[model samples]
Target: MQHRPQNWILILDFGSQYTQLIARRVRELNVYCEIHPFNKDLATFADNPPNGVILSGGPSSVNDENAPNINEDIFNWDVPVLGICYGLQILAHNEISGSVEKADRREFGRSELIVDDNTDLLKEIPEESVVWMSHGDHIKELSSNYEVIAHTDNAHVAAVRHDEKPIYGVQFHPEVVHTVYGGQILQNFVYSICHLKGSWTAKSFIESTIEEIREKVGDDRVICGLSGGVDSTVVATLVHEAIGDQLQCIFVDNGVLRKNEFQDVLDIYEDQLHLPVKGIDASDKFLERLKGVVDPEMKRITIGETFIEVFDEAIAHDDSYKYLAQGTLYPDVIESISFKGPSATIKSHHNVGGLPEEMNLDLIEPVRELFKDEVRNVGRELGIPEHFIKRHPFPGPGLAIRIISDVDRPKLDILREADDIFISELRKNDLYDEVWQALAVLLPVQSVGVMGDERTYEFTIGLRAVTSVDGMTADWAHLPHPFLAHVSNRIINEVRGINRVVYDISSKPPSTIEWE
Candidate 1:
């Protein structure tokens, strides 16, 4: 049963990527919330009604023949409502008589939100506050009950609020990092209008998730897939604390792991934390299936499917392991099953199946409710090593796909050496935390360059350094030329099999930072 916290906010998703961000921002305030499709009957969720309703931004235009719309009953509901982007347009069309027109100046990118002198929705958002906009259609006319409260240079009606009802609408997206004070605006909505209690913190999530896991697992033995990331470390530590010896953590050393990552991770869990863990070196198995696989998607699938096979084999040795536990965080779970399940964020972070379904074991996730940063906090709370918690984001494929071309042991070794040097330099300067992600990709195409008067054809190492809040969007980090020069010099001079290095400067829109 979904626990309904006081004064909940119901988010009706319209298939916008930003919809989950809306719920995330609301949840950040400790206000309970739920997300559902726009067309879901209001009564379907009214058994535990939200204190307020939020309509999410979407791709479809309200004028489209099949555009999604909120339930008509939502209008009659005695609660506050806030509509965003396409949501605002839907509200406009439902309340007013005119349809949305394809905009001559379709709003995109960052803009200043000029607020009306008298409006509560824009109450503390400040005049000329930064906002992110993405929409092609504009509300041409206002209904009798709706009044234009805020506007942008391109959008005449950036925001609207009904004077009589607690309904408000905005054409701009306030749920993204691009929008300054966007969080404050959402805080205002959650606190002032929805009348929610701000008590949902990492500690609260930890307690609730632990209790839920205990109830589900009962006396059955649980197997935790320790992925050696902050997510897995925290989850395994929590379950260990909860069930002690009954919980067994299986840490698979997929051959594609970062250079020496297998042993280093094993040390932390077994030696440092004294965890009930077994380190399985299935690198040979994983690398065998991954040979010559160039497509990134295929690489992920192969690794995922292989992990399931290896884990199943391990569990076979101990029939007592009845539960298959994972360190799946909220973001990963949300995007994986969003279209099919109740999660709003899962539509974004699809962690393709790492395990096969035939290994049918009762599923248990201790940290399913936690986000990335929150998982780190819980790791610290559970006495995990600081170094493990602060480690850079490591994709589960290990290092196979990080090598932009064909997967090979020699190329993998060189790339790891270069990556280690890059990370070491970043750490020496205390710049690791500042960088969102920094990795070295070994480009397949070798260039001819004279080294010590000897004709040499060596692999080029592509250096990617990006700054991002979430991987969904990112900007290239401007490492001081001196730093880049030092890293390039070290990789070419100290590390073998590389003569050239290039810095990736493109942002997330044009580039994903990862070469592959």
Candidate 2:
């Protein structure tokens, strides 16, 4: 079994969009936490109970016929329990069926929270402060065993606590920033009430991960695919530290990478980090399979399948390799096990999903439980260069999805040049680290434009730059107009890609970061 921190928080997710945010907040306190579906069997954690339990808010009302019910087993654990918006209502409804009902005035935004008592959960919070409220239902009456700890003008039961148990519930969302003292309230619960120390840090994680990897892959050879990205690099470094020369890493050039990215990344893998690595130039093979593939889904499948084939060929003669290590992160794991059911297919990832099944190898994902930023921390702890650690996230499919048309050599060349200019200018102007991700897309639409004094019809290049904490949601970066003009002029003037350039101004809801 993988080694995890002994003292951690178990967050039961109720299909809330903000559920992940709660986990993020907990991890921000340097306390480890994991999110599981609301209906998960508590018996699974019987051997290793969490230090505390947090019930996340959801969209469903407790009165609904099919509303998600509470797993009463949590209380049996005898651990400190805290519930937010919908969570609070569920606790009350569990006591009496009709205890929670629709409110006459729904609170959707900020409100003044009046503190009736500030002994424990509400400790350090001000008497009157702004708190965010998004629920439409409110508790009509509290159980005789529970006492009111705080209230608001619209919600008398804004906060409640059990008479004797260390259980608490709050109508307002303390996981959000809108709440004035939200962090303080959570600190109070995590530290004072649950008595958990903030000891989960980068150094501890690296030490534990190396030991676990060593135990799991003893005397067995492991093969890892390198994408030159932070996650894979960190995984490779960690595995190498555990088993040294027993880990073999392969970096494949898929023909769709950025300009000079293949050699540049390979040099770092060999020289800077000094891991056992092999650079495979299968660009011709990848490009041949990608020819005439116009649909984005097909493009991703082609790349993923091609990747598996190349990796399989590279290791076909080596029967000693028994494990395949991937750079899968926590968000991907959470989305796979979501209780909300399968969401619509926006775009398929380019990871080699079929590698293990085809290659007959056990899988190893050391950072599978860490978020993107957390992986960066692990990378830093492993002594990866700071510049490489902060590199913007690149899709596994590379420039395939960026081109909104059929893949081809000329188109790839045009995109590479345009993208190089945009990215280089961002760094030159000290704006590279400002945005989470920035890229240039080659649009299929061709428009008329004038360069010098001639009318020209050429494909337009779309420039996208976004500010985001995680790629889950993003807003278009409001770059300085003058700086954008400079990049646009350079792309149009330098790259021979006929004419026009445009900037994407849409956010993640209606439009994704990539055009495809």
Best by TM-score: 2
Candidate 1, which segments miss by more than 4 Å at Cα?
1-8, 15-17, 32-49, 73-78, 103-119, 125-133, 151-156, 176-181, 333-351
TM-score of 2: 0.95
1-516: candidate 1 lDDT, tens digit per residue: 233444578888888867768877887787767777777767766566778888898888787786676687886678898999988899888876465889998889899888884446666767788899999899888887888888888888988888788988889888988999888878777787777778876676667667766777778888878877777778788777777889989999888777788898888888898989999988889888988988776777788788777778988877887887777665555555554123333222213344555665766666665567667877887777788778877777778768876687888889899999999999999889888789988888789988899988998998888887656567999999999999999999988899999988899755665654
Candidate 1 minimal-lDDT segment of 10 residues: 341-350
By summed lDDT, which 10 consecutive residues of candidate 2 come out lowest?
335-344
TM-score of 1: 0.88
The true-structure Cα RMSD of candidate 2 reads 2.0
- What lDDT score belongs to each candidate, Candidate 1 first? 0.78, 0.87
Q: What is the TM-score of each candidate against the true structure?
A: 0.88, 0.95
Model 2 Cα shift for residue 156 (angstroms): 1.1
Clashing pairs in 2: none
Q: What is the lDDT of candidate 2?
A: 0.87
Candidate 2, residues 323-413, lDDT tens digits: the string is: 8787877765554333333233454456533232354667799988888899999898889999999999887788989999988889999
